[model samples]
Target: MEQWKKNLVVLWFGQFLVMAGMTMIIPFLSLYLQFDLGLTDQHEIGIWAGIIFAGNFVTSFIFQPIWGRLADRYGRKMMLLRSGFGMAVVMALMGFATTPWHLLLLRMLNGTISGFNPASIALISSTTPKNRMGFAMGTIQSGGIAGTILGPFIGGLLADTIGFRPIFYLTGAFLFAASLLALFIVKEPFDRAKAAAREQVSVLQGFRQLSGIRELTALFAVTFLIQFAMMSPMTLIPLYVQELHGTTENLAFFAGFVGSVTGLSNLVASPLLGRLSDRIGAERVLGCALLGAALAFIPQALAGTVWQLLAARFLLGVFLGGLIPAVNALIRKYTPDGMESRAYSFNTSTLSLGNMIGPITGGALSGWIGIQGLFILSGVLLLANAAWVWQSLLRKRPVRSKA
Candidate 1:
């Protein structure tokens, strides 16, 4: 492999390991909070569970943009190293949690401190040429998706056999290994002349730079909506599965399968859709993906069995697979060289915010309205986004030119 490809692979695998380690907690943490710690009452369990789950994303959301700007100012490589090493230590400490509050605090701290994805992404985006940005981002994205796909299955097995705390130790050890690899294998080619050439923009200045780009601002709006649509399902689906089946047996297995299915869809669709967007345009491709995603939710709401849900999730994954890469490419197309990291950072923070909100929203909705309501609401949001984008494009084009 070429040097850049090698870097991409290492970064990808490192991220994969880190995400996998973090997500292992998801499959079993609720049970740990309820049965293990005796947090009785379904409502109380929901509240604490939501907090433990959303805590990390909320903190991560707050810090992501800050980390992004820091990456640009100092170095992407440094940020990646910091995130990896920090997460490794934090995850190890999680194994020692003796109470729900302890776990929740650690999870919150995990989010505030951890940032491997943003760091690796900043480095990758900065290094990639605009033409190949979609492919590069897709590859990096697949790593995290792959980890999600794998985490539940592995976690389920560990939870059933070895126990929850052991999984944390395993996660910590793996992350420790990943951190060492990241510190040694990944290279950030710094240009002192170029670094000096970059204007010492403040945080507000970075926001100002994004504000000037109308397309990116609109794209960021779309990104938040897209994440809101996707993340809620991720937060609720495992619980939904548990409620439906009335057992945790094979929960990880099913959840992992669902997660893997999404990755599989992305793995299959990203390159194909990306190449298609390159030929046509990202706008049209994204519009189609959004519409298809809205349609796919129908089957999910109507799912009568776990198999049906699995199938719906797999197909849903296919439709939404290329959306992020397409969106990232659009942002890259619009953003200048030095500013790419901050833009992505800001966008990711928004995504983290969406992630933080999604679970809370899903849990609340599931409590009041029902899971089906979530599908309909999320679908309506996506359809609205698609219509808005389509109409906005139409408004921007000169009718006389078409004539």
Candidate 2:
């Protein structure tokens, strides 16, 4: 196989392992808080859960751009190794947490070290053939989705069987193995002298350089909105499913199924859509996917049955599948070659910001506006973003405006 193909194959498994470990905590988090950490109050558990979950993104949002700039100067592969190994240690330490604060501290450390996803994206983007960028990104994305689809299921099962602490150990072990695999399998043909010869700037200077590019900045905002719109209603999904099902028995099972179905469809659809985008145009694919996602949200908002919601969620996944890779590809296109990794890192920061804000907004909005209203609001936001993409991207004109 070609070097690029070789790199993709290696990163695929690495991504899956890393992503699975990350998502594995989702199912058992509140349980762990209650059973192990001795958080007796329901209100306290809710607050801690929110804090522990958001803590990682908070630090990651602050640090990803810094990592990206470093990746541009050194190499993405180096950054990947650093993140993969560092995360492994942090994850394992979580298993030793004796208190809620311990877990919270570990979680924050995890976020500070978390750059695996964006680092891997930047590496693959820099290495892959331009013509195959979409396919590469799509396939890479599928790995993460596969982990997400499998993680909660495995975590739930493991927590029931071997207990929660061991799950973290297992997650840490998997990450270590993944990083080890990358060490031998993934290769980067980095020319650092050439990179060093280019004008180097402070991280802030680099940020200014990126912010100055109008289309890239627009693309970054679109990336943020894409994540915001998609994630906004997810925190309320289980409750929505319960509302539709109206039964506690098998409620968790049904909720898990509904959650996994979207990821399942996303995993299957991403590479296929990416291939299609490569043949046609990533912008068009992104535009269509945005519109399809906006439309798909309607069925979900109006879903009278859990099955209806599942179907809608699955369709939403299929449409939303192509959006990220398309955005990544477009970012790669618009970015200067030497600064590609930093561009991706900055985009990743926006994504982290979206991730942080979405659930908080969703959780709050569901209370004030109802679950269905949150869904509709997400749809409306996507619709507006689609229009924005249409005006900003499809017009085929440069954005000369200042940031």
Candidate 3:
């Protein structure tokens, strides 16, 4: 009913649709590369699929800060519209791809244009009340988590029923529809004068500004570590599931269930932990979640059965749910008022950086140290991260009180 609450509800759905659209191709990407694109060899399909997926992140990482600067200058709503519409068009063109190069180029372009999530986060952070910011962010996060959890399933169905190419068409259309809702419904209280004043600060100046804010600098590290910890064990999950469950009837279903359970629990827990953060403070919630996730990983590493691992993952999800929202809320709390968009964008880049590093480290080490070792390494990384957060927040206490 409230204005900020209204923004949350609309943007929640928009984030959901956008995330769903992006991930909808994950299930059948290799299939499309093989059948439709005529890549006959298994190794060739794997190589092209990795290239297509990694190409997006490579461009996305490079382009995010640029988009952040533009969002700060032009208004975050405009950035959101740019990403939404641009991505929609790019996605639709993928439906017509006749070669691997076509899909690869389109995906890279999509990444270069992709700032929808960060733009939405920046806009919502600026619009929401400071007290309720954690709650709002958590709720929005749940939408994306839910979408990520379900998109592959939906894409699989769409693939089965209508085939591969039409899946892209449907995803593109859904994206356009979500953007339409955002265009008409989501409102931001923009000030041209403020934007003009902000334009005076150059990009290097902005980075220097973040460096001067000790808490902001530390929080950025926390962001990267949180993502690294979450992603490190991800690539080994299917293998772990099979090891625990055995190759039985419906093995793929079990693998999918274990993969999704963490996100499902995240969907259930984010709003609750977010509200908790609002009451007790985001920093406290963040430290606790980091520690909780670390401990949860130990049980996961020790699990002898699929059900045990699933339970541990669900617990891990419950803690992991609290992290990004809390971190975002803290960023909003500490960042200079006019620089919120760029700050969040920088945070998103840290996320992308972690995405790149985590899986590589996990995969490389899994062979030498083994799959269980990756989980242990992740827990150690997270525990160290939790300590860093504790010290960082402690240092901020005196400065915050003086302010």
Candidate 4:
């Protein structure tokens, strides 16, 4: 294989293993609280379960920017190593948890310590040539999509058949395995002088730097909106499938399938979109893609059958496929070279904030307004963000527009 292809594969595998560990906990946690831990009341269950999961995002939001800065000052490899070791420990300890509080603490620790994906992405971005960056990042992102597909399915199956404890053990083991992959298989082109001279910026400096970049600011805004809109889909899709009369035996499989298909779609679309973005510009692709996402949700809202919903999701996936790689590429296009990791860290933190807000908001809307309302709201928000980004980045088309 060529060097680009070789690096892409390693990065994808590394991300797949790391994210597999993280994603395993998401679908199973609420069930665990309700059945395994004996939290029976719906309100108590929601509150406690929310706490256990949200704690990680809260801690991660606070720490990601810091870690990104650290990655910039040190090296991407060092940051990846730290993330792998820290997450492995956290996942292992989760297996030993005895209560909700124990799980919450473990999760918080996981968030504070976890920064591997952003680091690995930064490394991939820095190591790959500019022309190939988008495809490279897209290929790696496909790994995350794969993990999302597999994690919940495996988590549910392992929990039901083998046991929940094994889920954690498996997660920890996978993360350790990813750590080794990062340590040995992944290679970086040397820039010893730049690496040695890199200076760590304060968290405030990192934040300030990200804010100052025009394209990055726009990207961040879209990040926030996309996250807020997608929260409902993430939290409620499985429930909706159940409402449509899907069987429990197929629940995990379907959920994983939805996620995996999205990744698969991205596998098909990302490289194409990335290449197109390089030709026509990232902003144009972003605007068109966001609009496509907004339109795709219409079918989702009106769907009367499982197949309809699946088709909608797959279409949504195709449109949304190139988003992350585009964001990273745009960030790279505009951000100072040495600050790549810090920029990604800020991006990750913004994403964490979205994760914190998306599910809760989606749950609330699903309960109060109805699922249709969730889709409507998500579509409207995305469309609005798409418009704003277009006006800011593409409409005016200033001579020096960073995008």
Instruction: Specify the highest-lDDT model's number.
Output: 2
Candidate 2 has its poorest 10 consecutive residues by lDDT at 394-403
Which pairs, if any, clash in model 1?
none
Give the per-residue lDDT digits (tens) of candidate 4, residues 256-323: 56545665676678777877877777777888898998888888889887788788888888887767
Model 3: residues with Cα > 4 Å off, grouped in runs: 395-403
Q: Count clashing residue pairs per candidate.
A: 0, 0, 0, 0
Looking at candidate 1, the ten consecutive residues that score lowest on lDDT are 394-403
Each prediction's RMSD to truth: 4.3, 2.3, 1.6, 3.1
Once fitted onto the true fold, the runs of candidate 4 whose alpha carbons sit more than 4 angstroms away are 1-4, 30-46, 190-200, 238-264, 396-403
lDDT of 1 by residue, 183-277 (tens): 78777786657866788787678888886766677667677877787777766777667765578888877765665676678767766777677
- TM-score of each prediction: 0.85, 0.95, 0.96, 0.88
Ranking by lDDT: 2, 3, 4, 1
Task: Give the C-alpha miss distance for residue 268 in model 4, angstroms.
Answer: 3.8
Model 2: which residue pairs collide?
Answer: none
Estimate the lDDT of model 2.
0.87
Instruction: Rank candidates by TM-score, best first.
Output: 3, 2, 4, 1
Tens digits of per-residue lDDT for model 2 on 84-146? 999999999999998999999999898888888888998898789988999999999999889
Model 2 clash number? 0
Instruction: Report the candidate with higher lDDT, 1 versus 2.
Output: 2
